[model samples]
Target: MSELETLNWQDWDSVLVVVAHPDDAEYGLSAAVKEWTDAGIEVSYLLLTHGEAGIQGLDSAETGPLRAAEQQTACDIVGVNNLTILDHPDSMLVYNLELRKEVAREIRIRKPNAVVLSNFEVEAYGGLNQADHRVAGLAGIDGTRDAANPWAQRELLDEGLQPWITSLIIITGHDEPTHTMDLNPESVAAGVASLEAHKRYLEALPHHPKPVEFIPEVLRTENGFAKTFRVFGV
Candidate 1:
């Protein structure tokens, strides 16, 4: 329980958020995203999967497009206009070289100073983390490095994307966070709205109660609603 450092969001001009599924960012990061976007920081989302296998009864064909739309709505609510959903299979993400390359390509193209990622650890304060989440987080870290190395992913260079080094990486939903971002009341409300945008998806989860209040409730702090992250530098 070391004192968490405060992240100066204004220091970075652009950030690219990489996550496993549709609602992943809305869980906690959306509050901070609201704060960042309000300050005119450019933000983009790179979702590895559409969370097609999230709903129990629905098949991939139905759930994929539905989840994608939900994610877009959620991002829009949080003021994120750039959202990209990759064709990676939901619930079957792997932290392999190919995945790293795909993520690196996005990093190169975006050239963000900071990258936000989901927790890669096996467990968080909430509970055991999912396989897809872990894979995506791990791949994001590797991709951050690969994006800076010209020889690492040569195909991206051939595609006219130049190598770019990211300055910071922030891992949300960490068990022990090193940095925190305090959110204003408006940011908290926006985060709630962002999660609520996933109406159909939230309805499908039997365990989720009061979906709109979920994020604000879980991430509330004494100062204000806050999001925490484990910071890494490149």
Candidate 2:
């Protein structure tokens, strides 16, 4: 296999991570978030759903707010202070025009150099990619384009949102990654803590794997801990 390319962190001053649900970023990207924040890069999170249906036997009403709170704590651990959780139904996400416009609005508001998202592919190395994940990723990709076009979402412009285009889109959980970012020891620790912050969510899982055990493996690189992404230049 060809070697993965190195992501040039210096080129990005800020990033807006758009994902389907809570704890999504913590799975693998939080380490990169910690690393970037340590370097003084601004990072924000935009969750399309609160992951209300992630746990079985849990009412979505209660689970929604609970997961949101957990996500906020997770973000805090990873040094992300800005977070927005939209009220989209879990497991029923659709990459429709409305969703695309919503994501575009956030992009215009945040004005980041790049956007990060989970993989949109049908299957991942672990198993079938969740429906919400796939939909959100596809919407995120289109949203970037919509944000750049003033005519695409004219109502947003009327509402005082200006068109903005990010330089790149970075997708995690890809079967094939194009770029990798090495994480420092501090970042690795912070990443572990970030996932651990999802206490209730992890507990609800049928199998509870400690964050430290899985995080290091997910973030592993030839040199050390790292995070990988499939980058698309916009």
What lDDT score belongs to each candidate, Candidate 1 first? 0.88, 0.89
| Runs in model 2 lying further than 4 Å from the true structure | none
Clashing pairs in 1: none
**Tens-digit lDDT track for model 1 on 1-234?**
999898977877889999999999987789899999999988999999989998878888999999999899989888898999998999898778999999999998788999999887888647887899889988999999999998898999889999999999888888788998788989888888888888888888768877565777878887667888899888
TM-score each candidate: 0.96, 0.96
Candidate 1 least-lDDT 10 residues: 206-215
lDDT of 2 at 140: 94
What is candidate 2's lDDT per residue for 1-234, written digit by digit as tens? 579898998767789999999989988789889988878888999999889998788898999999999999999888897899988889898778999999999999889999999988988758888889889988999999999998898899888999998999999888898998888888998999999998889898858779999888878777788888899999
